[model samples]
Target: MPNVPRKPRKQVAALPVMVDPKGQVRVLLITSRETQRFIIPKGWPMKGRKDHHAAAIEAQQEAGIIGRVHKQPVGGCNYWKRRSDHFDYCRVKVFMLEFRYQLPDWRERGQRRGAWLPVDDAADLVDDPGLIDIIRTLPKRLATKHKRLALKPATMS
Candidate 1:
């Protein structure tokens, strides 16, 4: 049998975390407009926009939260599904980006709704374990890094 090239997978940027006052962390989950499934906000990269910009936009549009990308893309996961015309699995790649921002006042959107879940409970709310894991580690990692840097001593004159 001859080897055939598979279709290139599309890239999607997702923001899975948000921080709130009282120093608590939350994961922003979105109900899909069409599927009604709980998912982290995500979207394809927009023209002339940076990856982080796309991520922020997705967070606002899907979750109705205003946030900024906190770290470099942590990682990604790939899965396969059949396309409209075929029985073969088409690969899909989902990128993970951590976001730091505050929740916005919830107003009715076209069809989607956003919810903020405590970091500990986020995994159960999201369908994908990969996304869950991302939410799990984000708070500790970000907090530790920020604290460590903040506590570092200044160099001697």
Candidate 2:
């Protein structure tokens, strides 16, 4: 086979975690608008929003979710996008969001469905190996995050 040049991958921001009232960490998956494949809510960089904020916006638009998005990415993964007759490689940076209220209606409410699951179940549900690895580690990351948060008050002095 002849070697073919690959196009530069595009960047996207993804929001994958949701913390429940009981402190359980759940991962959110939304169906892709085009293929209905399960994926985290994701989108291209918005005009003025920061990367994580853009991810937050995607979470809202795609899943009717509103939450506090962490400034740093939890992980990244590469996937392919299908257009009319071509595939484009896309690199996604995933961020974690602290769960908050969900709106009854949102921009993409009719276009997709969102589901929350345990880290292991989420890993099984998503297609990307990179995402699965991140999902598998999310529980541990959440534990560390909660530990740090629990210590914040005592350390404030």
Candidate 3:
């Protein structure tokens, strides 16, 4: 018998961001259930939803956030999902979700903690280099998109 390699599992994530009253960009991050480490909300793709929509759903479930998700993915990152016996390699596509409103209470409320942090602080909290890069480049990417769309700017309140 010969061994064969498995492909990386596909996943989706939502990068939830907002500009505060001071016009400072901030990102929302949730603590992982097991490790308690800061991470963006992500999960396996839903059967009936688009990738970006699924990412939005993940954000709602994991972080209790609802927002407008960009149709296009900004970037992707590969990570190792820990399992009981071994680790599974996963590639996650990241979508930017414009913050709308937060629920007073929602599912998974007590299981995890969510926080809004400055982009640089949020990037520094995450462990993955690829994810870090995405967070670090977010402000510029967002500004470019707003410019391309002919919007006033990304200094949304």
Candidate 4:
């Protein structure tokens, strides 16, 4: 090979969330293994899974949370992933997971910590600017989803 440039790795992330009884939305975040920097549940592509499904798997493994992952991705972000020999830039596609339940134990439970915070706080905690931008737009996207859901009953009848 003459001088081919390296392509950024593609990854998927789960934007796990729950809505309180009062209608406030909270987002779930986890710490990265090495640096312990706040981040969403994310990982590399799986051989037999679609991007969103893979994201759900990552959430389950990393955060011990299970949910329905929205088929359409909410947004995406890019971050530099540190590797042994060199660093790699990775592009992440974030899928929203509407949490159903949390497990008591999970694969990465001992290796990482997870937290649920308001979107603003979650945005503040994460170091990635691209991820922060995605977090900022989530509330509007969620509101639109809820409004559509609220109107569904009327249209059904």
lDDT of each: 0.56, 0.72, 0.83, 0.81
**Model 2 C-alpha lDDT per residue in residues 3-103, reported as the tens digit of each score:** 23375464655655555546666777878888888888887887777889888888777787776788989898988767787766778888877666677
TM-score of each prediction: 0.67, 0.83, 0.88, 0.87
lDDT of 1 by residue, 36-124 (tens): 77776666668897766677667666655554454456555443323456433222234343454434433335567667677778767
TM-score of 4: 0.87
Query: Which of the two, 1 or 3, has more TM-score?
Result: 3
Model 4 per-residue lDDT at 78: 80
Considering every candidate listed, which one attains the maximal TM-score?
3
RMSD of 2: 6.7
- Residue range with the least summed lDDT across 10 consecutive positions in model 1: 148-157
How far is 108's C-alpha from truth in model 2 (Å)?
A: 0.8
lDDT-wise, the better of 1 and 3 is 3
Best by lDDT: 3
Model 3: how far residue 154 lies from native, Å: 17
Q: Give lDDT: candidate 1, residue 100.
A: 41
Q: For residue 150, what is the lDDT in candidate 3? A: 18
Per-residue lDDT value at 113 in model 3 = 82
lDDT of 3 at 139: 83
